[model samples]
Target chain A: MKKSDIIKLLILIIAVSLNVKTMKSMHANQAEINPDRAKISGKPVASFHKFWADVKWMMFIQHMGSIDLTTESNSKDLYQEAKDILDLDPGFYKVYELSALMLSAKTPDLAIDLLKRGQETHQNKNDWRLYSMAGNIRHQETFFNKKVNKREKLREAIGFYRLALKKPGVMPVLEKTYIKTRAQEAHEANNDVPLVIAELLEWDKYVNTKMAGSEYGMEGEGGDMFLSLEENTKKDILSLIQRVKREHQNNLAGKKTSKAMLASLFKGIHTCNSCYNEYGAGHKFCTDCSKPVKVYGICPNSQCRKTHSNGKFCEHCGTNVKPKKKKK
Target chain B: MDETFAIASSLWKRLLGVRVVYFLTICAVSLIAITNMYDILMIGESRALMVDTGMMLTTIAAMLTVISLAFDIPKELQSGIASVLLAKPLGRTHYLMGKLIGVSWVGIFITSLISIGFVVIYSMSHGAPPAGLVKALFLIVISVIPMASIVLFFSSFLNEAVAATISTVFIWVGYSLASLNGVTLFDLSLFSMGAEAFYNYEIPPSYLLKGVVSALLTAISIVCVTSFIFNKRDLQ
Candidate 1:
């Protein structure tokens, strides 16, 4: 090789060696992500905030586009990063809003707590726009979580909005309108009246009655919402309950929902190979994830020549059976 | 001005056949595929995730576009295209500005196409595009201007591989710096800041004014410096 070629080759070797060393250092640094030190608060400085943002971004990178129960553990690091950001700079409303939105699904309580912290800290900092966000998150949680104690969350939301209304510059109209809308939402989200009423009926069967000669009252639905009635009201309630039970018995006997009929309606339907979240028979795609559903009768591999959806796999080539995509 | 436009048109035409354009197009389509891979609405603020992911991908596309264009500059110099252009009455600054605008055009076009694809895929279920998606697209488009300019500046002195590498490092560093909460030097923040501010609805008039100014001034400054360097350099 010429002198120039030799020099170029040497430079390449040095560059490669340095890159390998850098890669090793990066790996070593990555291994230092100890969850134990996550709680250590940094000083309220620009560098501290950047460090926290980096930590949060790391967590987000690992668990991007997922906020299901599976991603909850990753949310812990995000939780710490959020705390660090807030502890360093309480007026960073964007971080609070982002954390609240992300953590609200898997860990609503943590999400709620973060927003509450934001509200108090931001109030101290004299920034009142957070009131809208705090209230909105509460409502959003209630809307998303099927098992949410709607009354409690709604009340907390209202409390935030009320405090926001008291903030010097907040318009009365907007606050009042937000409260009204949220209150209406609370009513709707209280698990539909019929669903709650059905639970109350189930409670009447299993609670407030003697069991095996024990005159003990059991905890009922609606928490402590029910109470002892007056004499006349008690008599009327007893009669109404007896009549409703009779009607329920009659309806139970009269209703005709055949298992075979249901099977017929559900014929050829299948569950999603992934998630299994919303099953439908004969579905071309997984109803939830929109991926082509694996089927018992057809090969999934596009290269497989087998055309039938038979047994577990294609008999000719043994490709896993999946639903065939309709040709456009 | 006409000459500059001619140079820009020629540069843009050349870029049409480059691998970066295809890479960015695939990146956009890959985003849709990735979105399809998940039940995207599974998260809190599903809409927010959609917007944020799309914006970040566009920024990445912008970065790669800048690198691609910057690398092209060195290749042009080696191939005598720079010398041939200089043989004309064209000023160095005008040539630099043309290259800047051409790369930006390519960058913004890729970003906007990808943004539109993301919007369509995300909003197809809802029958309408999500709120702030258009604004995010505009921010990404704006952010690419400075990114392309920075890469062009690097290309003025460095060879292809070095220009591409340095451009990527600088852009990433700028993005990281911009993401810092209290960083007063907003000029380096790029479009990521625009994405954050607009998506979060934290944008005041001052926020937008500052972001626009930062992007414009950075691009102009980088172009000026690149032109000065190109004029001073002795060509073979």
Candidate 2:
């Protein structure tokens, strides 16, 4: 062999060694950047870890597409798929979310566990959707399974929402959810309608403001699905607001409510003092109870008849307002 | 270096003109149609499934192009084509380097074409392909560098069939091999962005820069080793 070739071989050996060292350090750096690297276990077929995860995810979605979720049982296969997907790619946020939601129907504990795993391994620590879903699941579990403590589950769900609210870029729906759940807890413990209504109104105002600011915000549906929260969160809040308003209106009207309180709460609607039934304009009595109700807000002057304020005179026209005598 | 580049350019043009290249491109585009039809079946995950399938298909095509070098090199040597070229001013190292660049170019070309198809299909159905997907495709193209060099290195000593098999296996099992024994050499999974692309997460520019640099370094090192081996082998 030529002496030049011998020197070249020596240099090659040195170069390859140095290259190997550099690669090792590079691998270390990569590991540092990806801390959740430990989630992937077992020898993957063909090292297509991400590819196989995709295939698994496709299968999952395909199965989901095929089955009617209402009829389908929470089988062990679902849990296995969740484990397989999470194991294959811990960074798969959608897999965590959609699968956990599916699992939460019957296996809520597993769903919460999966969500917790997602929170730990997800790159974005500030992600609120996972926490929100976990809270939704937890809150739901209390209703279906009587075995669990209702108060404890409610507290945990509220805690999850609280944590979610602290994170940046949290959706307004979370705050609304937190309020609604807290109201539920309050109402369950004490049957306090006013306190729940007040909390619901606060959340409703916040969500409505957010909705007003965005072009995509949906106005609420009426009380068709009173059992379930609506898909459009703004709609859900609006629906809740309307429901609570009715409950509060009834509660306030049933009591010895001041005229100012009735005016502020009902806003242009008149209610019977005796029966708490609503009355139309020009009606001297409640239609339901036939009880005499003095419509005091109308101007007494025949020349300038208009709705008047609680003051002695009409605000729309300078005419004296008087309490008319009720019919015997 | 000029001769090497000239050889590379010619080989690139020649490979692009091949009938198989056209067939592969057609296959890749049609595969997109098949996945598009899978939209109803994938439920909410249609976009993700399409992206993953597209990336996997692109990787397979690029790897095939790279593996074809094994056959090309050995066939040239057996047919006295390499001898005729070596009889001139062309050095064996230059020849190998040219083949590496040329084959890698072909792989990259095919990958780019398929990527365009993927992006277009994805946009039509899913509004727009995410930025991360484009980055993933770019990384796959960059990874073909090391892959081409590995095939070249193996073909320098081993028979065409053995070289092709080993190269294919090495790339296929890259993630497992890396995790199994910390073997970073020839680990192709580093360039895989299948998950990131599917999730539509942003990939930092620094990561891409690192990938490009790493691919170049791996390619150069393997090429150096290949040249050394090829220099000692008797042409006859």
Best model number under DockQ: 2
Model 2 agreement with the true structure over A62-133: per-residue lDDT tens digits: 676676753335445676787898787788777888888777877788888888888887574558788888
Model 2 C-alpha lDDT per residue in residues B1-236, reported as the tens digit of each score: 99899878877887888898889788887886577676665555566667777888888888888998888888888888888888889988899999999999988889889888888888888887788889889988888888898899988888889999998887777646555656766566667766766665667777777677778877777877788889989996
Q: Give the Cα error of residue B120 in candidate 2, in Å.
A: 2.6
Residues A122-214, model 1: lDDT tens digits: 223334456666776776766788787777777777667655544555543533334354435444565443322333232233223422222
Docking class of 1: incorrect
Runs of candidate 2 with Cα error greater than 4 angstroms are: A1-47, A61-74, A91-94, A121-129, A164-302, A308-328, B175-185
TM-score of each model, in listed order: 0.47, 0.73
DockQ (0 to 1) for model 2 = 0.45
- By summed lDDT, the worst window of 10 consecutive residues in model 2 chain A runs over A218-227
lDDT for A179 in candidate 2 is 76
